[model samples]
Target chain A: MKNTFNILATIILVLSLSATVCAEGWDVPASVKKKQNPYELTKRNISSGKKIFQTTCKSCHGDPGKGNMLPLQPPPTDLGSQNFLVQTDGEIFHKIRTGKGAMPTFEKTLSDESKWMVIAYLRSLDKMKREAVVTKAVVNPEVTDVKIDIDVDSEHKKLIAELTGLKKDGKRVGLEGIELSFLVKRAFGQLDISGEEAYTNEKGQLIVQFPTDLPGDREGQANLLVKITDEDNYGPIEEKRVVSIAVPTNPKNILSERAMWGTRANAPIWIIATYVLGVIGIWGVIFLILFQLFQLSKMRVKSK
Target chain B: MTQKTSDKSRRNFLKSFGVTVGAAGVVSSFSLLGAAKAAAKEPEEMVNLLTADGQLVQVDKNQLRPTVTEPLNELQKRGREGIAGKSFVMVIDLSKCRNARKCMDACQNHHQLRADQHHINVLQMQDSEHTAPYFMPKPCQHCDNPPCTKVCPVDATFKRQDGIVLIDNERCIGCRFCIAACPYSARIFQWTEPKDSEKYKDLTYNIEANVPQKKGTVSKCLFSADRLREDKLPSCVSSCPNGVYYFGDRNEDAVTNGTTGVTVRFSKLIEENAGYTLMKELGTKPRVYYLPPKDRAFKFNGDLLNEENLH
Candidate 1:
């Protein structure tokens, strides 16, 4: 019985050791766990945190904190899970600041305030998840009323889009912290404004400098589109506005246009004149030689 | 008395001329006998010939001669003209390059060039010892005001409207004047016969493709003009894994990265990246622009030192 007990104990010890070895167990220090997050959970902090997450951590953590399943040796932790949420804010902050195994340490990269902001953002994600659940239970979620105002300043060469909306609570509010993608509807497809996703300001407005070279219709009219993409709280909303862009009267640059290296039609007058003269001179010489040869042949025949 | 002497001298010259004529007849008769003997063993086979003006004629096999002159075909004539309504441009982001040498390999393979001859070169550049090192790939600039085209006496090298500088090997006299004139050192001379297959030798010469490269002719990058005609990316641009090169029509104001398939506005990308052309002071007006090596993805490791050691 003692021998069997010894074998059983050995197997248990080996299994536990192998498990620890398989995944390098994260050891969060007691002191680190006690550390408190300093940043307040505000909308601005959450937005900046979201931006950082999208740029840096989203590649592995995915959009909603669901792990991307990238076949890592020890897979990434799902940040949105109940187990992850149960961890103290300090524990999450320590994990991000002092990375373990596959995760890289962002201590040198991110500041202390930024780390706290990320933690606040993580907490807000839990609220978003709860809100999403409550939203699904509602029979008919009222679509947010969205309005877009387009102004074309031809003198300054700027196209500005002013957006305002009414929340479901019957309150007129500026759609702050929402992404507004501005695009010019082209013949083939929509051309993105500056290839950048524009975000609305606190006043619910996004302004983009009109591209001076953007071609328009026959009447110099451009179809501009502003869209607020679908998210957890709001349904998708879009607005299209037609704006008259200034007709570009500037002439083409001389260097880019009819230069010497350009097409034959654009060849310089001097080159054409020289070419014509050279051709005529060579042909004239040839004709003159033939005429002289004919005269010499006649003269020789008379002498014979 | 002098007239009498002159008359005598003239009579003497005539007497000598008669003797020489008599000797020439004897020699001619002997040659005719030799010709008769040669004709006895001559082959009777005769070949038919078609004259250029559509006249059919027959000639002895010995009388048949090879034509020494041939005219340029349709493709060669059309090659001088550029594609209509297109102005090509290339932008290279220096921050993205890591001396992969894939562009050089692709260019060499497509051009059928030897190991020493490269149409694209990845050069290691460092402004100073204090500054960081970067890899700069140098290809033919295909300048809008190309110095190489100007010095070409035979018009062998010419620029097209679509922003490509091409070399017509048939017209190149191996003078190397364009090579001397080019500031970028982009041109290369084929000092020896190209080591190509017999099939390539039998294939018709293409001015755009520049395949079966001839000996003693100057050659440079054509921006893969033949490939451009097919609406395909240049070999170097498509082969690069780093998306260092962006090529597109300047008139359309768009440039696309061949590797990443990321299209950006030509003017905006240049403006945002602070793109600058090489040797702008020279006024060559190169179509290729370079984005400064800022915000590099990877550290400038000592790999360039290792590459230098290999060299």
Candidate 2:
């Protein structure tokens, strides 16, 4: 009777442990769940977030509600689903930062501001949240003859951008409400620093904190680019300034060593030597066999 | 007497050589030289010319129209060589490809190929019964050690320094040895005249483009050598709607995504994504690498699954 009771208790304990392991809810911290999105949900901010989602997130999660996600063992969640809508913005943000199973963690790939913008974009996708949050279209104003200037503050580690445009009567005025992007030039593309919400203030100045952890050249020189974010309104206006910041990086040369695939003149010495030896060996054997046959024929004739 | 004999002999030789200098014997022995010098001074009116039969003649310069020079020789010479200090590499991310067929269409149009012919083919591949199916876009591997170039009886098929395998159809003696040796089956023989043969007939054959594709010659992918000369991405790489292809110089160790136009370190991208080459055991050392299809979003369905499509 005691053995039967013990067995039942063991079975119940094992089952309970397995149930906890396979639980559906992600264990998000209470503080993380309450943290609100920092960026404003503007039209430009949402569009910027949309581009990021298309490039990075769409591969796995797919189009929000389409049910076209890659068929995995445990499928990726649909962002448009009611289950996702129920979760707070902080819960979703935490989930993205620390991924589970097949989903990759976005902490390294995306910046904090970029993540907030992505959340804003996701909120805009829901009709109820779109009406509540995305009420204003704070985009770049249509200003022609705009000139941009960039200055680096070494003491404060800040990048300041000043925008000025010509008025109809040839008067230069500070252009306000103009969006700008801060990017560092990389080998193949640019790395975005300024968030979607980075806009010129009433004084036509945008003061952004410079990131200290960028990879630069041997001299620790990094090319800093300040550009108008709304390219459609402003026709590719931008400025570049070189700043001494970030750690130095030495890129490895994949082709520094001699490769096997080269011109015939550059063929390896062993290959040439092997070819010569092979030719001699094959021909020598053939000649030896021919000589033996000739000797046998002479002996046969002599015997006759 | 010696000078007279030498002059007379020279006059006889000039006569035999068909010099069109009128009354050669009556003029001084240096008459041909004098006339050529006189023609050189008056370049506006007259020009000295050499005939095919070793005859020297003076012609009116006004009658001469500049003959249009053919660039075929120059094209062939440069086509055999490749861009220096650059090794091209291509990376295909199978996870992103949705079988759009836009890449295939762009390649065919760029190469002037028929609907049946393909420079790049999108194949629906299923490894096993339980495994998920995926679309694999196959092009010339452009192997470091090309079997096609080795089996060629003539030097028609060759590998360029930029890791591209090109077929000089002009030198292909209608032999299909290369086709048999290639394990990838990347090559095709122009058994019939290529599509739009008549339209491209007058075009000076560009060895890089491999068009005006001649019948009875083997033709395969050339990595868009002509486009590379202009520093543009290959047609198939540039046409992908999804960020499926990353192409760039291996020497620079960078690759740019076709869709995003973002450049990244080649080695880092390959290392992080667990990139692999096709048939690594074959020892072909293909320049093209592939990132495995991890989490594909779309259903893998194609007409290739039909019974009639099976060979």
Candidate 3:
């Protein structure tokens, strides 16, 4: 009986442990877990991975792989957590390729290289202390003289930001291969331009065309902010510029206001007058006939 | 004695004729006075009148005329004159919709609509078998030249200057003329008394809000005219998880997506997206425009195919 009791206790313990593992943990094969990631964590790969994550994963996994828990039944795993970070790249790759439960299979959607790049991007997030990366440049303090000039072309609806790198001698030179981000400040928050990150051209300028009808304030004024985000060479520099767009005017359709076909407000004066006159004229004639009939009845009584 | 009796009868007849003529003249003169009063400009003084129930009521001298109330009151008037200097417009991007019925739910809650009554409906549309299915949310087109308003004998349904079409439930006679005339089939008639709480039931009806909805009246989307007056986005626009609907003043040429808070050029969005109004051939000149379902975010899952399951 003592041996049986020990056996039963062990069996129950094993069952509960397995159930817990099945519920939360993935069942990755041994061979798949041992497989290695073939891609390197290069700057280009990390950026590409960021783009993919934003477009594909941000909706469910959130901005920094924190996992949006509201919509999912069994919430998505937090990719930034240590429990997730401890997993090998092969396990993650296999789980992504062959999805389980609520997670979708991304094998057909992402190429192997893209998958590896995304894994690298996820790995990089483990080092981030906060949700957003705020890089303060301590490298070259002399690059503080960079000036950003913004011009708006109303006809084409384009906003051009020109970045001029100024030397200590006060000479203007164009900076190349620097990433610039342009955003429009709105009432609620900032609206970033689609394809917001742009590298400076040969002229050291980044031009972005806005939608023609992008609304500004009540006065038709839009505020644009341009930032230079090159942490390695220069500190973060931001410039703000204001531009005015055409304000929409009221529609000029007078026919809508008229009361021709039973519009109550602006009914024609003549129609109301005619209707009233006709009612009075018809009623007067009927009253006159009724009086004549009464007069005739009196005359007949007199004759009798 | 016979001559005396005949004389008395003649006197009675004369008196009766005089009374009849006097009454007729008084009635006609009152009508004439009403017409004259309508033609005259506003008077500074107020007027007192006796109603049919023997109650004396004091009213504005201008309202003494039989013409429709010059300045519409809260209950008796149609809200045909929209908020001035505004022309509202909406744009729906079909590519972003994933049959999330949050817009409908929001509208129903805000409007206090019945289960069968939907001011905005999401329809499963497939142009052809080769094309992928997509969800199309249909609200009242709020046409500039609304056919529904034209057929309304009572002028209950009318277009406002701000590009909203509203129904005056107090004025609607339940003729269903507007319903028949509407090509979009946007209007819904309340067949039975609406199940409303006592609070809404006791409240006076406002056309802009269409709240405390009455039975045997036609109701459709008013584009949240009351909310517009408050300078807020419509319930559906703000409630959408996906940025499907955009609302703005066409006069402003800018439409903001309530979900993303991204304001875009209304004309440019329509032009670039090859946006088309529903049944453009009808020439309804709808205020609503739809962007095509190109490059959709998700595959058209057949979840909404059986709409009964959605309820």
- Give i-RMS (Å) per prediction: 13.8, 11.9, 12.3
TM-score of chain A in every predicted structure? 0.53, 0.43, 0.43
- For residue B189, model 2's alpha carbon misses the true position, in angstroms, by 2.5
Between prediction 1 and prediction 2, the one with superior lDDT is 2
Kindly give the stretch of ten consecutive residues in candidate 2 chain A with the minimal lDDT sum: A254-263
| Model 1: residues with Cα > 4 Å off, grouped in runs | A8-191, A194-210, A213-304, B1-74, B195-197, B202-205, B305-311
| Predicted complexes: DockQ each | 0.03, 0.08, 0.09
In candidate 2, which residue ranges exceed 4 Å CA deviation? A1-45, A49-145, A150-226, A232-235, A240-263, A274-304, B1-70, B150-153, B173-177, B252-254, B259-272, B302-311
| B36: Cα error in model 1, Å | 49
Docking class of 1: incorrect
lDDT, candidate 2, B200-240, per-residue tens: 89888887889888988888877788898887888898888
- DockQ score for model 3: 0.09
Model 3 residue-pair collision total:
3
Give the runs in model 3 whose Cα sits over 4 Å from its true position. Answer: A1-98, A101-242, A245-262, A265-304, B1-80, B126-134, B294-296, B299-311
Q: Between candidates 1 and 3, which one is better according to lDDT?
A: 3
